[model samples]
Target chain A: MRINRRRYLTQKVAKILIWMAALSTMGVMALIVLQVLSEGIPVLSPRFFLESPRSMGREGGIFSTIIGTIALTVVAIVVATPLGVGTAIFLGEYTREGRISRVIRFGIGCLAGVPSIIFGLFGFVFFVIYLNMGWSILSGGLALAAMILPTIICTAEEALKAIPYSFREVSYSLGGTKWETVTRAILPNAMPGIFTGIILGVCRSIEETAVVILTAGSSLIIPTSLFSPVRTMSVHFYILAREGISMEMAYGTGAALILLVLFVNIVANWRLNRYIRKRA
Target chain B: MSAIPSSPLKAEVKKLNFYYNLVQALNDVNLPIAEKRITALIGPSGCGKTTYLRCFNRMHDLYPGNRYEGEIILYPDQLNIISPKVDPIEVRMRISMVFQKPNPFPKTVFENVAYGLRVRGEARRNLLEEKVEKALKQAALWEEVKDRIHDLAFNLSGGQQQRLCIARALATNPEILLFDEPTSALDPTATSKIEELIMQLKKEVTIIIVTHNMQQAARVSDYTAFMYLGEIIEFDKTDKVFTHPSIRLTEEYITGRFG
Candidate 1:
């Protein structure tokens, strides 16, 4: 009876400690969100989103930066999705676990751990200087694509692995070729997971400032073409805060960025849940 | 060797050997699959019964380093199904399989049944509907699923899902249907239902089954091959093999003495 009471007391203490840790984590997130939203919400007027900045960002709005962010992100996603997904398929399906596959996986693991600032440096050198792309959306977008490739490949590969091996066998026994099996039996089932990866890539692209600033120049004008230089919202926020240009505008941009990321995550999770429910 | 069946031959496996990398999984196995008849392969666990059954459709080719020796000759054409020259896809086109566990695609019941047809590039809406309906009916699942044909296959009961897999296999009108412990994951009622379906299906296609259940081999198979240690120790009529002693190992396994 004494031992049982001691065990119960220990369990209570452990539970309270864990509960405190979780509550503190939540507390930090709530504080950050509340601080940003309180300062930035009032600045989000219709004109702020519709008009271009003027007088070196001291007046007017940040319409051009929004367009720039969209264009750069579009270029990044369009280039990255196929390449990442294809690489994942090739790695997961075409090759057996051998020395070559192991080496390739090791390379991807190393790439995933590289800092984004290194990506910025590489983009500045290879894309801007060597390729003569100059400071443009194409350069920055390609750099962002490379930054997100490892994330997409790793997630997509995991999703592919989650499918039962029997599904492949069933497809093969039904006379379906490897390509047919992947497209019909495998990809359709893995779509939700793959979409989640893409969503993650989008979030990374939106939040990224270093790579965009170095490769895609901070042009205040909205981009007219893929080759045109433009400023993304995050880059705008970074410059505003760093140069002491406009603290209010920086907070406003930070709020928009947070809201966008949260929205994407929520929508992606909801869709994934629906898909799992339907399959179940 | 036992006397060959009097029925016309659908395929012949002659001195067949199979290897997985350096490991030999099937040794010098030979069997005759009679046309439109059921042949059952019975064995203790790890005796390579499923390995032999997979040879009929070149399933081992999907992986690296697995190799096949000798011939699995399909009758009429006399084509060696296991030859390196024959594409695995071509071999697979003529054969379909039902797995040990029910493996319905994460699709609607209609789509699950229609997958094989779609893979074969059959695109006419009316023809797809007809074939899907016919195959589902042939598998004895059409009546229960007719209304909810559009519903996801995962919603079906375990027995119904297995039947749906059978229907999916049947949709392509394969020349040979391979069953790799198709009913092992099911209950007694489902197992009996699957046995009945297999018996009925032999009128249209040749069948090669790998079963763990001795009673199942006795009930549904026209011919039975008892395998031990990756070798076929006895092959004969199911009744004769079950009732009479051909080899000590066969008798021992049949009488529940030892595997």
Candidate 2:
């Protein structure tokens, strides 16, 4: 009876500790969000979203930065998706687990762990200077694409692996060529997973600052073409806060960035759920 | 081997051997498949029945280092199907398979039934619809799934999914249908329904089924090959093998004395 009581007491203590740990994590996230939203929400207005910034962002709005962010992100995603997904398919389907595949996987793992600042440095050297592209969306976008390729490849490969081998067999037994089996049987089922990876790449591209500032140039002007220099919202926020220009605008930019990420995640999850339901 | 079917030969396996890398899976497998008839392979687990069945469409070729020796000669053309010169895709176009599990593609019921036809370049909408309907009816699943034809194949019950696989395999009107334990994953009712469907299908196409259940072979097969340890112990008429055994090993296995 005494031992049982002690055991019950230990269980109660462990439960409380776990609950405390979870509550603290949630508390930290909530506090940060609340702090930013409290200072930022007041600055948001229709003009703030629609008009371009003036006088080094102390006046007017952040319209130019928003366009720059969208353009850079679009370029990054467009370039990255095919290369990443194709690499994943080739790695997962075309080759067996051999020394070459292992080396490639190791290279990808190393790439994933490399710091974002190194990507910025590489982009500044290879694309901005060496290629003489100057400060442009194309250079920054290519840099961002390289940074996110490993993420997309790893996730897409996992999704392809999750599919049953029997699906391939069914396709083959139906007289499908290898390419046909991949397109018809494998790729369709892997779409949701691939989409998730693309979304992650988008999120990373949107918030990235070092690569954009170094290669794309932190110009406040709205970009006219791929070759035009521009500023993204995250870069804008970093400059505002670090240069002691406007903490209010920085907070506002930070809040908008958070909201954008959240919206993208919610829409992606909803679409994925609807697709899964229809298939189920 | 002594009791060859009286029907015309569809394919013949001569001195066939199979290997997964260095591990020999089938050894000296010789059998004759009759046209428009059902031939069932019965054996213990890992006895090479499914491996032997897979050789028909060169499924073993999909993986590296898996090798096939000797010939599987198809009739009329008399071409060696397993030869490196003959494309596996061409052989697969002439033959189709229904797996042990209900492996319906992640597609709608109608699309699942129409996949093989589309693979063969059948595109006209009206033709696809007609052929899909005919295949579904042939598998005896048209009435149950007609209203929900656009619904996902995964929404169907286990038995219904298996039938959909059958319809998918039958869509291209394959000359031979290979079943790798089609009913092993089903309940008794579903099993009986599949058995009935298999028996009925033999009138139109040559069938090579691998089954673990001895009774299933007896009920649906015209000829039965009993395999043990990667070799065929006996190949004879179903009734004769089940009743009047000529080999002691075959008798022991049929009477449930040992595998």
Candidate 3:
């Protein structure tokens, strides 16, 4: 068969455009990686990763900030996962295509679109002040949970919906109840998708500065309890850079942040692939 | 296990009428499914054979807006399966179904077979193992899958997956089994295996099969019901239905004159 010259030329142009679009994204990522490496590599040292901040983050390391970052993220995820997964199941399975479900879905969509700064204000007022938690990790975690709930719920619901209706029919015909079918078949199948949502939420928590600064105080001291005020890595990096206290420390924190992101992406992709392979 | 069929009628259908919203799918379906025997419902596509088969276990209850006006009275218990008072879950437990396409759960073979028992609160490892093995054997898939029972159900071929589904249904020890065009997707070899298994399975449980293949019904079924446009046109012994049908429509259908 002979190809039409005009159509072939059009197809060639479209292919080139697609290639250009894809390369542009890759080029931007490479540029950012190069810029961060040049600025951050010099300041990143053993002491920067080990010792507590001293003299307003100019003299010592950011070990306390690292611990605080992980602690708050862990708390956020622990609280959010169950709430998000339950909400997803309720929305996707029990009550699909109805007035209440539509309203809940709309609410979730709105929540996801809200700006990070507004979430910070909400955490500061509702969690820190109103709840009297006094700028602690608990308050920050609670706020972060609320912020990431929409992402988790949406992804989890998508996962649940992806499962074929035939599976559910088989379960029912086997004398399984709704709860039994969900726990045994639906949840296990949807775990990888749910984990992807959690990984994204974790990534968000890691990079977040405003919410942490407002709800979790930027203290140099390492936190002893959930009540104690502490600074996350993002907030510490933000404060150092904003106050012109230490550019070196800020770059080092940025480098660490980049590495954490790389680690998370690698792990998430690996875990997801493993699960998909197992399912197949 | 009752080797001898105590009564001719295992389940008596009286004034069975089914509707999908305003559209009536089955109209006044009345038939007696024999005890410990295979009763095949044969008809063309959209002839209400599959729809009538679904009503046996109340499979239509899964979706909303599906209405049933009937009494499917199970013998001995005499429970009206379609009644508002009786739970559909309990009815399904006593009567399980195997679908057209193989739909094995995304779990191990053992887990898939053990699921029915586990759902009923059978947690003891020995009991589950015993029942799972028994069901697999009954489905004639034990030798093929015994060594690899721990493997995922999807790892099996299409026919094996269908057998696994059958094993899963059989594991629950349902008194009645409904096979809805079960061999429609199978190759001749797999189809023959399943047909033989169905005949053997009738000794343990009453079997109601819906098939388009006239030869399959003739081979396996004790009785045959020919349906057309949501109504039974003929119901008689398999030999009589194939050799000398009472209705012209049934004779035309059986002789390949037209659907």
Find the candidate with the highest lDDT and give its number: 2
Candidate lDDT values, in order: 0.92, 0.93, 0.90
- Give the 10-residue window scoring lowest on summed lDDT in candidate 3 chain A: A1-10
Worst 10-residue lDDT window for candidate 2 chain B reads B250-259
Alpha-carbon runs more than 4 Å astray in model 3: A1-3, B1-7
lDDT of 1 by residue, B1-259 (tens): 5959989999999999999999999999999999999999998999999999999999999888999999999987999999999998998888899999999999999999999999999999999999999999999999999999999999999999999999999999989999999998999999999999999999999999999999999999999999998899999988889999589899999889876
TM-score-best of 1 and 3: 3
Cα distance off (Å), candidate 2, residue B238: 1.2
Off by over 4 Å in 1: A1-10, A274-280
iRMSD (Å), candidate 1: 1.1
Q: Would candidate 3 be rated incorrect, acceptable, medium or high by CAPRI criteria?
A: high
- Can you list each candidate's DockQ? 0.81, 0.86, 0.80
Count backbone clashes in candidate 1: 0
Q: TM-score of chain A for candidate 1?
A: 0.95
Q: Which residue pairs show collisions in model 2?
A: none
- Give the worst 10-residue stretch by lDDT in candidate 3 chain B: B1-10
- Residue B246 of candidate 1: its Cα lDDT? 85
- Would you list the rank order by DockQ, best first? 2, 1, 3
- The CA root-mean-square deviation of candidate 1, after full C-alpha superposition on the true structure, stands at 1.7
What ordering of candidates by TM-score runs from best to worst? 2, 3, 1
